[model samples]
Target: MKKTITAALAVFGLVAFAQAEGDVARGEALSVTCSACHGTDGNSADAANPKLAGQNARYTFEQLLAFQTGDRVNAVMSGFAAPLSEQDMWDLAAFYEAQTGTVGEADAELVALGERIYRGGIVESGVAACIACHGPNGNGNAPAGFPRVSGQHAAYTAAQLYAFREGYRAAEPAADARMTDGESMMMRSVAYKMRDFEIEAVAAYIQGLH
Candidate 1:
C-alpha cells in the first residue's frame, strides 16, 4: 500500500512541479490589496477566510484560476480574481507561499476521533485516509498540488468539506455552484461518505496540526 501510494503521488507530483515559477518580489507588491482579508502576510484573522500563508504556490495558483474561471464559486473570490492575469495570480501565490502561518488549538474531546480518521479511513464507508495525500504531519504534497492543511482554520476547512459534499450530491453542479474540487472530485468523494460530526472533528484537529 505504501509503495502504491508513493508511486501514485510521484506521478501527480511530476505534473504539479512542472508549473512555471512566479516572481515572489512582484507577488509581494501585488499583495497589498489582498492584505485586507488575507493579511499582509496571508495569515487571515477571520476564521471565515482561509490562511494562505505557507500554502504551496501551485495550489494557490490553481485556486485563483478556478475562481476566475467560475470553477470555484465564491462571489468575493471571483471578484478578486476576475481582473488578475495568470501571471498575477502566480505572483500572488508565490508571495503567500513564502509567509508564515499561525495555528489554533484543537478541541481535546475531538482529537482522538479526528486523528483516527485522518490517519486511517472509515473502511466500511470506503473513505480514503487523508494521510495518504496530506502526509502525517499535514505538510501536504506540493508536487501533487495538495494544499497544506496544517494550521488551517477549522471553520474554513469544515465549510470547504461541506461544500465538497454538496457537490458530490449534485448530478450536474451549476457553474455558480460551490464545488471547489477539480474534475477528479476526490474531495467530494471522500467528504460525501463522512458524517457532519466527523468533518467537524477532523477540521478541529487540522487547525492544530504542525
Candidate 2:
C-alpha cells in the first residue's frame, strides 16, 4: 500500500508545483538576517521554526505579505517582515524554494494514525483530508497557492494548525469581509473542527511525507 502511494505521488509532482522566477543571488544576499531563524539554506535548526526549503515562491511571498499586512500575526515575524519591500519578499521566496527540505522520521506508533487523518480525514466530524490540498506526497498545489507541507517540522505544523483553530488568522475586526480569501477560511474551518489528537497525528504524517 505504501509503495502504491509513493508511486502515485511521484506521478502527481509533474503538475502540482508551478515554478516562479526570481533572482536567486539577490535572494541569498537578502536572506542574511533570515538565516538567524530560517537558516541560510532555508532549513531551520529549531523544530519550532518552519523550514522554508522547497516552498512555493508565491505562497512564501503571500505569507510574507500576510505577516506585513497583519493578515497573519506573529510578533517576531511582524517585526522581520516590516522592512521588506515586495521585491525582497519574492527574492527571499525564490531562494528558499530552491533549497531542499530535510525529511523527518515519523513515530512508529503514530504513523498509521497520522496517515489516516492526512489521507482520508474524519468525515463524520467534517474534517477534510489534507491530501486534497497538500497533494499525495505533501508537495502542495502551487497553482492553488497551497504551501508545501511534506518534510515540515511536526511541531511547527501543529502550532499553525492550532493557531488557525483558535482564530489567529482572522481578519482584523474592522477590515472588510472581502479581504478574507476562501482558502484561509477553508483552512480555519478545518482546523476549528479538528481535535487536538488529529492535529498532532496529521502533523506527524506530514513530516514523513517526503
Q: What lDDT score belongs to each candidate, Candidate 1 first?
A: 0.80, 0.76
Q: What TM-score would you give candidate 1 relative to the actual structure?
A: 0.88
Top candidate on lDDT is 1
Report the lDDT tens digits of candidate 2 across residue range 104-170.
Answer: 9887777898999899988899988989989999999866678899889999888888777766344
Query: TM-score for each prediction?
Result: 0.88, 0.84
State model 2's lDDT.
0.76
Count backbone overlaps in model 2: 0
Candidate 1 Cα misplacement greater than 4 A, ranges: 1-18, 171-177
**Candidate 2 TM-score, true structure as reference:** 0.84
Candidate 2 residues lying further than 4 Å off, grouped into runs, are 1-21, 168-184
What would the C-alpha RMSD of candidate 1 be, to one decimal place?
A: 6.1
